[model samples]
Structure formats: structure tokens, C-alpha cells
Target: MKPAPFNYFAPESLKEAITLLERNHGTSKIIAGGQSLLPLMNMRLATPETLIDLRNIDGMKQIREVNGFLEIGAMVTHQRIMTSTLVQEKCPLLAEAAGHIAHRQVRNRGTIGGSVAHADPAAEFPTVVTALDADIKIEGPGGEHWLKPAEFFLGFMMTTLQPTDILTALRVPVSPPRCGWSVQELARKENFFAIAGAVCLLQLSQNRVVDVHLGIMGCSPAPLKPLQAEETIRGQELTDDLLAKVADLISEQVEPESDLHGTKAYRRAMAGVVTKRALKEAHHRASEGRQ
Candidate 1:
């Protein structure tokens, strides 16, 4: 099905885009890459009267190192991120996650900002960003504001962004030395949404865990931070006993819902299994310093 009739505007600048959004008020939606929005539009789930295309905006597609973070423009394609040497060196977790986002065609057209703005509960980028403590930048008539990943996602398919706000970019801090990271998901086929997924980031000092961040998706309304579980690992040796305890803590924290993918019991059980496996693999990688 085709999308319903709507007035399309390709703004040349961010200011013009914000002005157009303000002029349209509640009747507009921003289109970047259209990888997710177009499908919703075709299904008649979203029928905005005005569509603001942001493709022509300059300076919104850059990927560079700014300060201590890797700043990625909202329009940077997934494929570009997957192949970028800088991203691979600085944030290999993001590159690995981007490589698994759908097929080549979809990745070539999908933008990181678009995915984050959509705030799909099952998407890899959102979970990874949340685990890494990334921040998102937004611009509107009110000027710019930054939101941490935890606060950025309010609920499934919803965010703190106003209708008039356009996500400008995402800022992710560079991983520290000996930082362990891993992402694991269970899908019937490659690139499909996971039945259960986990992303783990572990900071180690002298073979002991200094900090732990674990983010889970596809099992909750938004990415689950599982802070209680993280606290169980912090300042610990991450020995076999501690790992088991950490996994048990994570299982208790998650209240997964039953759906077409699996039962609540299955999801809850797998969440623990996946978390344990991901943490172990990440710890091994960090110890070996493997690419």
C-alpha cells in the first residue's frame, strides 16, 4: 500500500527544517532515510499531513572524533559506520552492531539517528548506545539540547523529542583501555529482530572488574539497563561464582512479556543465558585484546 497524500518539503538547512516543522505544528513528520517511517506510513499507522525531508541539510553527515567522543551525524548510513576504520578502532561494538542491521540495501539507506529516533525496543543500536552511555543532540526552535540515552527513550516508539525537534547527531564516548564489549541476539534468520538480545560493556583494571554496564532489548518496553545486576559485578573479580550471581540478578530484574516470538518464561530464561554468555565473551576479548 502507498502512503496517504502528504505535502513533502526538502529543507536545505536545519533552520529551514525547524521553521517548517514549527509552521506545520502537529501535522508534520521528519523523514531521514525513510527506512522505518515509510513502512509505517504505508501501513496507515502514521499519516502526517506534511513530510519534512532532511536529505539536503549540510554538515549533518559527518563522522569525526570530537573531544573524547566519536560524534556521528544523524544522517550517517549504517554501511558507512560498519566500514569506517575510525569507528572500528574507537567503538568496535557499534561497528559490530551496525554490521548486523538488516541487509545491505536497508543498511545503506538507514541512518543511526533515524533508528534512535524511532526508538524500536528490539533494535541493536539503541541497546548498544544505552550500554555505552551515549548522548543524542536535538535542534528545534528552542535551540539545541542533549539527552542521555537512558532519558532519550521514553517508551517503545516514543522519545523525549518534540514534534518540532530534529535529531542532529549522536555522541558516544570512546571505550577505555581493556574495556570488554559484546552483543548477542537470537533471531530465526539473519538481520531479523531478536527474540532476546544483550549488550555488555565491562571495564577492567588488573584483571578485576571496575565497572559493568549491561543493556537488554527485545524483552521489555525499552532497553533494560539492569543496574542491580551491574552493581553485583562492579569492583568484583568476575570469577565463575560472581558471574553466576550476576546472571541470576539479571534474570530477576527483567519482567519480560509473552509474545509471538516466545513465552515469558522462555524470554526470561534466555535473557539470563545470553547475558552470561555475552559477559564471558566480552571479558575474554578484553583480556586478549583481540580485534
Candidate 2:
């Protein structure tokens, strides 16, 4: 099905886009790469009266390193993320995860911003950012502000963004030395959405955990960090038994809904499976000094 009739706009400037959004009074949607939104519009799941395109805005398509953090423009495509040498060297977790997104064409068109804004629980970027402790930048009538991943994402596809606010970019700290990260998912097929997924970041020194971050997706309304589980193993010796313990803690903490894709019990169980896999892989990578 085709989308409902709506005004289409390609704004050349961020200010212009914000103005158009404000003028529309909550009936407009800001579009970046059109990878996620177009599908929703096509299915009539979203019916915004005005579509304010951000693709024409040049400022939002950059990757810069500043003050120990990588400021990745929201418009950065998944394909680009997978290929960028800087991202590969400084934030290899993002590159690895980007490679798992839907096929080539979709990755070329799908954007970090659009995915984050869409807030799909199964999406890779959201869980990656959560584990990385990333921040989101936004601009609106009230001016600019930044929000941590936890503050930016609400349940499901919801966000704290006002209708007139434009999410401009994401900032992530550079991965530390001896850092090991892994993305594990239980997808029906390659490049498809996961029934349950887990991301793990581990920093190791002398075969012990220096720091660790764990984030899980596809098991809750929003991607979540099982903080208690992470803390349980943080600064502790890395062991198979410890990993299993952490995975069990995460499984007990996960809350998945029953859907056509998987049963709640099944997805919840898979969450622990992925977490254990992710933890093992990450630990191996850390041992090998790979990131």
C-alpha cells in the first residue's frame, strides 16, 4: 500500500527543517535516509501530514573525532559505518554490528539516526550505543541539548524528543585499550531482525575484567542494560562460571513479550543464550587483544 497523501519537503538547513516541523504542529515527521520511516508510511502505520527530509542537510553526514569521543553524525549510513577506517579503528564494535544490518541496499540507505529515532528493540545501533554509553544530540526551538542513550530512548519506538526537535548526531567514547566487544543475535536469517540480541564490551588487563558493559535488545520495549548483572562481574576474574552466572542474572532480568516471531519464554531464554555467547566471544577477543 502507498503512504497517505502528505506534503513532502527537502530542507537545505537544520533551522529550516526545525521551522517546518514547528509549523506543522506535531503532524510532521523528520526523515533522514528513509530506510525505516518509508516502510512504516507504506504500510499506513505512520501517517504524518508533512515529511521534512533531512538528507539535503550536509552538516549531519560527518564523522569526527573530538576530545576522546567520536561524534558520528546521525545521518551516517550503516554501509559507511562498516567501511570507515576511523570507525573501524576507534570503534570496531560499531563496524561489526553495522555489518549485521539488513542487506547491502538497505545498509546503504539505512541511517544511524533513523534507526535510533525509530527505537526498534531488535536494532543493533541502539543496543550498541547503550553498551557504549553514547550520547545523542538534538536541536529544537528551545535550542540544543544532549541526552544519554537511557534518557533519549523511551519504550518501543518512543523517544523524549519533541515534535520539533531534530536528533543530529551521536557521540561515543573511543574504545579503550584491550577492549573486546561482541554482538550476538538470534535472527531467523542473516541480516534480519533478531528475536533476541546481546552486546558486550569488555576491557581486560592481566586476564581480569577492568570494565564491562552489557546491553540486550529484542527482549523488551526498549533496549536495556542489565546493570546489576554487569556490576556482578565487573572488576572480577573472567571465568566461564562467572559468565554463566551473569547470563543467568540477565535472563532473570529480561522481560520479553510474546509475538508471532517468538514466544515470551522462548525469547527470554534466547536473551540469556545470546548474552552468554556475546560474553564468551568478547572475552576471547579481549584475550587476543582484538577489538
Candidate 3:
């Protein structure tokens, strides 16, 4: 299959991009990295009358820290994040998650904003951003706006972005001291989509769980933060029984669909197992922080 005929535009500035999108209205699709959109277009799953490429737009490729938040431009690639010392310093969880995305080739071309905009339920960026409570920056004819990850990701391959909007950057809070994080995912192959995945951020104070965030992916319509599990673990010591209970609760909360790769029951079970492992690793890291 081949993509349908389309007009292509590579705007040099965000303002120009917005103007192009507004002029095209709903007939155009924004292309950054083209990792997801190109594949969809080739398969005839997506057919936009106009394709607006964002690569030529400057300033969108920057990564900086401001006011304790890491500001990552939309054009920043997964491989860049995986290797960035600043990302590793301020947002180690995001760095670890970026290392899990597909393969080296995909990571070399996949943009952070593209992954977030693509909003695959099992994608690493969405799960990590959701756990970190990151804010998405968008610009359109109407002006700029910010959205929480929950507001940005509507469902599988869906987002709240308007046709005329451009995602410019993401602002994520720096991981605080006493925080430990881990990303656990299960895929048949190293670079394949995960059947189930867990992103865990644990904060410990004097051997007691002070705060925790558990983001579950590959087992729901969108990344799920299991508040029940987080609440259950808070103020408690990291124990095997407690971890088991949290894992079971997370499994119950996820809404996995049965597919060729795995059944709903299988995904649910794997989600639990992954959640347990993530919690254990997170606890270990947190303990290391104390020592």
C-alpha cells in the first residue's frame, strides 16, 4: 500500500506551521520525526490531504532546564534523550523509559513530541510523562496552551490536540531526592511493542513509602496511573506482601484488550508481575539512595 496524494509543507518556523495548519484546516496532519505517521500513511491507515513537516522549524529541538523543570523541545529524539546527561540528571525516569522505545533505528528518528502526540497506549513516553505529571506545550492560531498528560492523551492513538495546534515542548519536573524509578515491560522481541508494562516512581522517607506513582501501559486504552495501588503503598514499608497487594490491585484496574499477541487475562497477569518487579526495583534504588 502507498499513501494517497498529498501536498507537503516544511515550515521553517512554528508561526508558519500554525499558519499552514490553519489554512489547511482539518485536512492536514503534522509530521515530526515521521516515525508513526509515515508508517500509517504507507499502510493506508492515515490519508491526509496535506502533510506539514515540523523538522525545519528551529528552536523546537532544544533541551533546557528552567525553574526546576526540564523543558524538552518537541523535536528532541528518543535516542537523544537516552544519551543526554541533562535528561539523565534531571529526569532519569524519562531517560530510562526512552531507552526502552522500539530499537536504535526507531529511537534515532522518533521524537518525544511525536511519541506523545501519537499516544500509543503502550508507548514509553506517554507512561513516563503521565507518571511524572509532565505538562505539554501547544501553540495554535488561538495562542499557546498547556495540558497535563491525562488531558493530552485521550485514548489509543488519540490526543486532545486540535488540527491547527502544534506541540512545541514538554515541561517535566525534576525527579526529587529520595526518588527511585524503574520501567518494566514485556515484549516478545527486544524492539517490539510491549504486551504489558509498568512505570514506577517511589519516594521513601525513613524506610516508609512517602509517595509513589504507578503508571501502567500496554494493558489499557491509555497509560493508567493506579491511584489505588499508590495510595495503598504510601506510608507503608516496602514488603513482599504489600508489593503483591499493590500488583494485584493494579492488574484489577487495567482494562487490557485481547489481541493476537496476548489474551486479556494474560496481559492482566503480566501487568501484575511487571508491577511487582518494578516496585521491587524501585525499592532497591530508594534504599540505595539512603545508603
Regions more than 4 Å wrong, model 1:
none
The runs of at least 3 residues in candidate 3 whose Cα sits more than 4 Å from the true structure, single-residue gaps closed, are none
User: Cα deviation in Å at residue 2, candidate 3?
Assistant: 2.8
- TM-score of decoy 2: 0.98
Worst 10 residues of 2 by lDDT: 238-247
Give the least accurate 10-residue stretch of model 1, judged by summed lDDT. Answer: 282-291
- Candidate 1, overall lDDT? 0.88
Instruction: Residues 1-291, candidate 2: write the lDDT tens digits.
Output: 999999999989899999999899899998888989999999999999999998889888999999988999989999999999999989888888999899999999999999898899889999898888899999998999999988988888888989989999999889997889899989889979999999988889888888988889899889898889888888898787887888788888988999899999898888989998998888899999975
lDDT of 3 at 100: 96
CA lDDT scores, all candidates in order: 0.88, 0.90, 0.91
TM-score leader:
2
The runs of at least 3 residues in candidate 2 whose Cα sits more than 4 Å from the true structure, single-residue gaps closed, are none
Q: Estimate each model's TM-score.
A: 0.96, 0.98, 0.97
By TM-score: ranked, best first: 2, 3, 1
